[model samples]
Target: MPTLEPSAPPSTQAAEKASRALTIERLQEQAALARSIADRLPWQLAHFDLDLRCRFGNQAFCDGLRIDPSALEGRPFQDCFPQDALPALLPRFMQALGGEKQLRLTEQSTPGGAHTFTETSFTPDVHDGVVRGVFVETKEVAGRARVDDLAQNKRRFDLMADALQDSCIYFLDPVGRITEWSESAHRLHGFSREQVGNMHLADMAAPRVGEEAEIGIDDTIRLAIDRGQWETRGWLKRAGAEAFWGQTLITALRGDNGELEGLSCITRDMTAMKDLDRVMNDLNAELDRRVTQRVRQHTVPNKDLDIFTHSITHDLRGPVRHINTFAGLIAEELGENASEEIRHFRDAMKRASQRLNAMIENLLTYSRIGRIDLHPERLAMTNVLEGVVSRLRQAAPDRQIQWEIQPDLPMVVADAAMVNDLFTRLLDNAMKFTRKVEPAEIQIGCRTESDGTCLFFIVDNGAGFDVAKASNLFLMFQRQHHSLDFEGYGAGLALCQRIVQRHNGRIWLDSTPGHGCAVYFTLPVETAMAASGLAALGC
Candidate 1:
């Protein structure tokens, strides 16, 4: 073996030293880089030595505790934290040091009367298989928790907004730019989310100008922000260039600093309500006008009827008494010597007087039916028809007629006496028209439609009129058939039309020359009963 030289030994020693130094430098660089990374971490980071002394603390930890990082180094963690919070924090720290794995803790603090929530984790730091210290990463959870809470609140608010049926809610900034809009707002204004956002509130106003109209919407917003709230009701423009009445309320929103941030707006569509009010007003006006006209038209006629009643009473009594007295005188004067012609004349005079009395009674009844106040009731139609047939049998004993009344006919809401009068007139017409047919037939029935409405019809195999003259059929004192064929004052059909109209129903005629006639009338469905409750009573 060759003897080692001193120079060679020195060179080899230098090389070994360089290699050891480089390894140590690499380890130091890695440690420094880790420290730098820990210091700049977004979450609060801190390191403690085995002696329970803080060896290092990042800028985030320093900021969170409101302490200087340089001053915090080498300080005991117990000394740095408040005395009350240390006990709770100690257990987690010790757990990480005991090799029980990392631990997490949630803590709370009320500083300056404001609560702060925190989530902290303790991770053990080991070196060369020896537990040296613990690393703590703390995150401020107060802000994140508040944000989550706000998100949940917004979800609930959105659901409530969608559920609303009557009112629309929206939000705008103090500068009048729309920020948020609800589903109802979209439906009422006919604006989508893309169309509404960033739009000025004034853009929703109607085109017309008036004293009640909004002039400067931006100025109104400023006023509202200053005063806290404002409200108004007026016309608003819709997407289709239509206008609708709306009631709007605006309120200012303030920030934590009590500075005005935005405005909250709520609008309610009142178009239907306004329309109903206008229609009611028009209807009342029309009713008043019609009543005035009717009073004027009937004043002279009523006076004439009164005068005729008085004069006819006196004139009829005088003639009837004279005829009776003369007939008695003729019968007594020609006893056993009386001619057959004399007896026949006496019988004829008595019969004519009786017929005259019957005619006068009928006239009085007809006038009463027209003038009497209508007292409507819900009556069984079957009973009414039976009553009418009984009355007709007594009136015209000589006529033979067949009645076909439908069983369980739908009940009609009308005046009992007026309905009786109507039936009497219809049946009397039928009897007269079908006098030559020998077997006169009359049919009455009802049918229910798909819409839940009921229709009533009266059919008669009688002398029907031409379709061209149907318009004149319901006029007062206008008779299509001759008086010699059907004796009537022609007031019945007109009265029927009036009664049907009063009940919010309609009546019409369907007939042709030499064919049977059918009179049809319609009543509203049950669903509409609530809207027109008085319709059942023919009001």
Candidate 2:
């Protein structure tokens, strides 16, 4: 009856007290969990009270500070640091304790003679919304920073080696086992990293090394170690079982103390260079041989021509002088009775001699053209054509011809006389073939192409040719048309093609059975100019 009167229920009081206890327990659990996490973290963690006194620390913090937890507890943080250093760090600690959640800072320490840089974070520790202490986590960055610097230096060196183009760079151990190989080394030696490592230099030299040459490798290594470098050129064996001449420069790698540690071998493939040198030597020898052969072949022929020229001048002159003297005596002795038949016979003999002399002159000119070296020069096509046309008009006064010349024709490089002869021969053929036409029409022009090539063309409304027989056009003395129809020895187009080839150009024909023929030829401008200069001076 007394409890039921008006007193507060016991259950309500109990529930209020239980709620308060639960809140306290939760807070304790949270604090315990926070402390446990702070202790287990890899970074050094320490807690200082509001007064900047050390209250708690993890094992990592004790190890980092080089102090025991029992020795550090309740001690002022300033007391633990060096006397001069404490003042500089005190402000940051105070700020952290004054409810600032994070305070990041850097400090220097000289545990050894070397100074170390430490990065640390100071965090405020709070309980029930009250600033309790500062939790400090520290890490040593000096060792990691040094490792990063070394890694960066290695990357730079690797990049430099990869960028090189010429020489192969690689490292070998003291026993001549491959250690490092670059891309250039792989390209030069034909051995990749997987195939090069653990392989001895002797194995790589197997193809080039005779049984007696094996000692040279050891000698080379010893010499490099003693002299700091060794260089040699010899044949080298490749991974693909191919062998090439190589020039190898091996440099000894040394430690800081200058003791030999490894070898840096740079091998260059000298096969192409050596082969080029051999080719040059062979070419020189061949040139000498050809000179000797030419002397042997032409000596007798040149002497024979000289003898023939002398005989024709001296021996033939004696007979002609005797005949003339006898004829003069007959005319003087029997002046009135000198027979007309005798005079006519003497005239015939003179004409025959003149014809023989003309034939000999033509033969000599043709022979000289063959033996003379080609001297090319830059020549205006219009000038050469005009000269040829002037000469042709004088030679044939009765022929009526229509000559069409292209304006501003491209310049050509060639021997002027040869080009003049070429045009003359073509003009003669045109005149001969177009005899059936009332008026002969000849056209000369040039076309410039996009590829910087110039095509010179000579077209004639004359006797056309069969397409199947065009191949015979450029052959010496191989005339598709009869001599009566073309009045040629068939040497003009042959000479033209040869000249074009010498200038690194080409010649071709465009013709049909009934269509007029067009002869097209090309000349490289730069090469033509150089050759023309030589040709003009007859050098």
Candidate 3:
């Protein structure tokens, strides 16, 4: 009977009571875990009720104010913050209470009067889509360490800039306002750093006194930002209304995030060099006039002209070599301490020297081409082409090239070395100009002309120049495109022309801009001397 009564279904109220006790135990455990985590965090954390009374404070938050966590709770916002800071922080807290999150970087003074920077965030505590209170978290940013590092970097930059005698370096804000003027800059421009501070970069431009119109500093800054760098040679204003010819280089400075932060400008006083250049140009023009007159009068023989060419190149080589050597020495002396601007100047010197040296070497080669005697021999055009193409292919293994070479090309009597050089130069030119083309197409073929000459043509889909400029295509130092667009000293085509002429062949080119170029040259099937000699031998 007792067992039957006990089975009277366990009371629903008793089952509910057990479940409620378990839930309360779990909630208390979760609350304790959350509080422990908040205390362990490095950031200061706190919560404020809608009435701006502190409801909760983590260990870090209480430690900052030198108060116990429980003691800090129930305190008003005004009591937690300095009276002066309340004006700035109270509105931000109100914003968060209204469900708007707030973030700010602030510099605050400690009780010891030391200033520190902090990044703080205020988040709205929401429940069922309603704002309940504001939760605040803050972290110190080590402002003192960052300030020291910046000072060190600035000192290093100043030391490097002051070492350059002929160049002045300055820095500009993103908007081209002068921010830091170096000692060298002050000395060169005769303007004190204080005078130049916050001045627009354009203010340094000379008053356009009898000079041609040039790009404004505003345009220069824009171009520098767009292109990473911009350089120009113009007159720059100095103190006392004087101006000096200056070579200016503007390099856009970017942050780690690839954002334009500012610009570094290097201006070299080139007034002396500019005057020297003008005098040299006048002397060169006079020398050319005299040389032309002497040639027309037969006073300067061909052999003498060759000697003069060699002598001039030999004389110029010494100074170019000295420039390179001194620049290298300076770079070695500076070693790792060489700043970016100094390295830039040194590299510029090296590049200019190298280019001039290359021009001289090519000139020597061109002179030798006209003097060398051709040894004519029979050559299979197909075999010559294969060897040339193979070498070119190896040099540019990554290029995707489509070759449309004609099979069984005709044999001709020509100098083996000269023919090889001709193909190498023409093909190399084709590859260079077509560098941007995909699956670059190059065709090589030969056909018998009506005049009984072997007419060979090489074609490529490449960047071609205006046909009108073709007349000077074979002249030394004449180029249809700027060196910046295409790397060349304008010597390759001139050498190719000389090589063809010495072999008694004619070369010409046909081209249109953006289309392509086709080069044509004629060669005799057999040399007249070789044919006559064979006949006399009764072959």
Candidate 4:
């Protein structure tokens, strides 16, 4: 290169120029970074010179205290906070400027008219090996950090229990009294929260005597407290309903010092299993009786009864169905060639076959109700009634019937499927009896008693029967109205009566010979018990 003229010995001056250029570039980057951080960071930031004057304050630093950043810029530090605050804060700032690399400080002050707390950090800004200023970062920690740890833990526990089905989770005080109740608890125990006051575990547990542990409520609590846990399965009754087997777990919730704080009671309803067990035992007993009778050359009474029922239902069905089939075929074949008397005889045969088949079906259904298990539940009567009305309307779409069903009916505890059947039968009967009346009127509703029992009624403005015949209303194969007028198998009311009795409920009728008839039934409430109103049924 013009020979690089004699490359001057790495010029010291050039090195100084390079260093200054690099420093200026680094400063520009630092300023850009500071601007980027001010907008991006959650914390508030500010800077003050050695003269203890605020030179720069980010928007957040001013906004938190409701102070304008523009007004506070270049103002003394005292202007940013209370005068009293400055005295305690000055020492931290002085320490940072006097060569401390970093300082942490906490102070309480009234910010925006509320008592608030702030944690601030001061970092000494050094230049040329000397502290030039302090860079401050401020953050407000809201109001003494008031936290409810107890409530938080309780919420966590409830969240864990919310996922369970067929299980009731509740809490009991150390003394065995109910404290907290969950929705599952209400559904399982048939008790609302308001009705659970001061109720102990013993109140719901069916008394057990001469069994393992020979344990009562006191024993249950003692075991849980002493052993820190207890689990058992037994019959439990609630709200005046029959006893149902349940598997219960009692855990003593202990404190840090191993002292009992309270107890957690988690009960899973095993009523279905218990019912199944009954069914199994019944089947076993029947099988054993049959086997024993076969060995001893004797016939079991139940077996003979079953054979008779089978003969009536199944064997007789063959001939009746054939008779109906042949009658229908004969009617089709005879056409116009048949005499009027012949046609009339064929029609009667068809009618009789249908009537017999209906009676058989009704008898089977009635028997099934006795054999099947009863599973009681809390029911929305409105929904049940609505479903019944829907089905009845489907069956008889042409009927001119007006239904005056009341709203907001009280919920009842009974087998839901049985309730549906009972409503369908009763409502259909009401519509059938009112066929002759112009604009048939049927009213279905419930009246709550002062004692909390519910009296449900189905009233119909129709061809009412004599109250004397009401006694036969729930008897098998008994009918008040002539079959020629109102076609029925005379099994609906009887089936309904059986269902009511199985539910520990009662059914009765109110009627005169002329105007209308009202059918009333009583069901126990789920949440609380009333005096058993057997007297009201006037049975």
Candidate 5:
């Protein structure tokens, strides 16, 4: 067996270096071919470095500027134009060096003693997230038609930006300096157009806490360049006022040649929503803290936990009752004069209060199930199931149902009252879920286990659910199906679970989506194994 060495041999190292050199040589060849193509183009093109000195010039550039090709390279931009033109041209070039693209339409005097309209554009040369130089493209335009079209489109966009009230839209140069500010932006940011000119967008950002504060405008610009757009939420400072929560969307605008031209920034004030979210988070934290403290102090019997639940629920009922009473009073006062919209609102209020009251009642019921003493006896499962089904049929008399009951079900030692409540909730669930079925079918059966225990199941041909979500089914306030399809408080299974636990039994379910489901539970048939009286709960 040969072992691999840690370091490469000298021959392998030489081969890698040769491969890299070949790749670089190929790239240089491609660059030269591109330059040759640019030299032949009719449009004048030149490159200038950060020092404002020309680095390269094509044939057209030398002919248009009337400068020798040899002298053009390494010459200052100021010497290329006439003395009078420098005043107007210098500022535009400066903006380009600062990462802003510049476009100018000027009338220039030709050597033939004639004036011609010229269109010039200065595009920044950015490399590796740094501004290296600028590329200048120039051509003579015969008429002013192109200039008129550009001016008209600019006006239309300005009008559109001004019309927005709740949102502010602004434009930035390629390097994130403010280039265009609208009237709406002025009102929202408290900055006039003159004040915002050449200002970096990051100046308006409010001081933020935590790690997010470390991310600056340059980071956002780079992200937008990579992803085309970026969205974030943070505080934006307003002049002479408190900072507001702003939801900002930054989009990178690119030219036809895939070069970054500018950025479009839109920010919407979201202070109210931010405040509401903070309030909710604080309330949740406080509630959790109080619940934790109470649990720690009352680690006694189940009776104490039930009393605590009852006391809190009792306090909550006062406000809900007030809302219900006031809503009814308002409706009665309006009487026949009330409009349909007002009446609808009044009814919605009533429904909300009623639903809240029902939830509280269910909570109380769940809390009491474990506290109350259990009376153990040999209870007949068949009779318990029959009574529950009879009440459901009476409640919904119009519905047709098919019942399948296995006769002579094995008896189980459990609390008759608790077992009856358990069957009522489970049977009621089967009926509610099967509301859409043509003929609802329910099956009830029980079998005696080898360990002297009875296993019972209730199968319903109803709207089923994925068996994977069974863990949440026994939790309070968890519903597998939508309430609009079938009405439920989401507490039936939780109550059933509580009852089964009190009797020292186990409960589980199995189902296939869109078909049906079966709930199974085990109860001890032997009296010795049955749990009786008040039992200490871990909860």
Candidate 6:
């Protein structure tokens, strides 16, 4: 091959040389820029290649170790820093290069025998599934104990902030400027931390035109500074979103020096509550305007409906009584001549009529309970329960029943007639269910709660039902037991529930199959005499 010189003119050679110099200059500029950026960082950071040699060291890293950055560069870490930390430090760097993406550790080193704790982050410089080197970001944990406390507190604080989904909490500088923000604040205002910095408190509110609407953030800040706290409720504009009703509270915070440092703001977004109130107001207005008129128009028909039901049932009873009377007369006249089948047919008709009458009576009672207005008065329930037990005893005179009534029961705020009726239905249930149990046991008692309400219970050792089906227990015609096993129309419990609800009370039950059942109910008590009396009765 012939020796070939650059086949370009002198000018061309100079231009090529000039291009190379410019490229090199640009690279130097980039390196300087990078160093400048690294030097401005607060934490000590450095990067190393696969050879464990320093690619770069920031100003903070060099200054912290009292080593020249230039001397540290392009030198193996072990040769650059010949100290005991070499053994502990190299392994962490190796771990990063060996495919461990992030290795965070707090290490203590005694270089020249001075204890220093460093929180080091060994992040692998990953490129396309390959770990090329390690980027080390080390922060000096100035006081390890204090840092620990801060970290723990920060975790707890984050949890609390997350839990407050509707409340936005933030910190404002002493001069009424926003300094810090929480996640809730970001969610509520749609403003990032960077976007809200150094913003005056007054700028947060939107302009409003109304005598009642005062959106002045300055006045709010002034009040907080003077009174150490302030609260206000008003419609607040959300960033990039619709306005919402907000309840905001601001309180002053003091530094360790006992000087005013910052203001803590807690703003609760009450959009749901506001919407509910608006809806309720609209509903009430509609009810007052339109519903009242409807009620007036329906008044005549409603009263006619009540009279129709009462009169029609009464008229039906007259026909039923005639049919029974005629059937009895036929049975007497044909006593010797009547066949067994005719007699059986007549008895069946009688039974059907009786059942129809019972259903009509029960329906009338249920309807009347809803239609009639209640007149509540304070009355001793023990007397009522005693009266109910006496009636139950008369109903089943042959059955030996044991009654355990707790003495000196509390007086309840209820309609006496309605309560007596309620107890009659319940005691009837207890006796009906305990028909099989010899010498059936029933316990009537009361319990006094921390609140003023008194809980009364009627426990019986009887055929109990599955508690899972308790939801249907108070529904009309919803019976848990079979009609064959127990004789009932299934309206007693439903009526009892209605009476309790009319008195603004609650009722529940506890029962297990083949064991026993207990019916519990609550009613408001008027005085200590009633509550204390119930409590004294082992309630």
In model 4, where do residues sit more than 4 Å from their true spots?
1-311, 328-337, 397-400, 449-452, 528-539
Q: Write the per-residue lDDT of candidate 4 for residues 1-539, one digit (tens) a residue.
A: 36556655578779988999999999999977886778576778888998889887777877765877668768888777666455445655766787664333343435564444456777899999988999988776543443233334545766777767878898776668776677778877788877875578888767556432246677888999999999877777667577667889999998677656568899988889878988999999999989777855543554456456756787778888999999989989999999999999998898889989988888777767765666666788999898889888999989978889999988777777888888888888898889999979999999887776788999999999998756777898898988889888788899999888766678999887668889998777775442243222211
Candidate 1 pairs with clashing backbones: none
Model 2 ranges with Cα > 4 A deviation: 1-350, 367-375, 394-398, 406-408, 425-429, 432-436, 445-529, 532-539
For model 6, how does the per-residue alpha-carbon lDDT over 245-287 read when each residue is reduced to its tens digit?
A: 7888999886566556568999998879978998999999988
For candidate 3, give the lDDT of residue 384.
95
Give lDDT tens digits, candidate 1, residues 149-235. Answer: 655666688788877776789887556777666788888888887676457788887745652555367667877888898876777
lDDT of each: 0.73, 0.70, 0.82, 0.77, 0.82, 0.78
What is candidate 2's lDDT per residue for 1-539, written digit by digit as tens? 55556766899999999999999999999988987887787778777887778888887887767887779888888776656444335555665776654333343446674445466667887889998778777876647677456556656876777766646788776657665677877777778776764666666674443423324787888888889998877777776756777777889987677655578888877878979999999999999999879986886786667566555645555565666567567657876675898777656666655544444454444445544667676788878888888988889899889999888776766767777776787677767667777667988888876656677788887778897866777775667777655565566667666556545668888877656778887764543346645454331
Q: Among these predicted structures, which one has the highest TM-score?
A: 1
Model 3 spans with C-alpha error above 4 angstroms: 1-300, 527-539
With a 3 Å backbone cut-off (N, CA, C), the pairs that clash in candidate 3 are none
RMSD to the hidden true structure, all candidates = 18.9, 20.2, 29.6, 21.6, 24.0, 23.8
Candidate 1's displacement at residue 522, Å, is 6.0
Task: Write candidate 3's Cα lDDT for 1-539 as tens digits.
Answer: 55553443568778988999999999999989999999999989999998889998889989888898779878998888666555446656766877777665565567996656677778999999999999988887755787455556656876999877989898776668776777899889999865774588888887456663267778889999999999977888889857998988999998677866578999999989989999999999999999778766763476677777778887889998999999999999999999999999999999999999999988888777765666777888999999999999999999899988999888777778988998999999999999887878999999988776788999999988898866888999888888888888999888988877765679899999988899999876763336333223210
| Model 4 lDDT, residue 297, Cα | 59
Candidate 5, after superposition: displacement of residue 2 in Å?
99
Query: Model 6 — which ten-residue stretch has the worst lDDT?
Result: 530-539
Question: What are the runs in model 5 whose C-alpha is more than 4 Å off?
Answer: 1-303, 527-539
Q: Using alpha carbons, what is the TM-score of model 1? A: 0.43
User: In what order do the candidates fall by lDDT, top score first?
Assistant: 3, 5, 6, 4, 1, 2
For candidate 6, list the clashing residue pairs, or say none: none
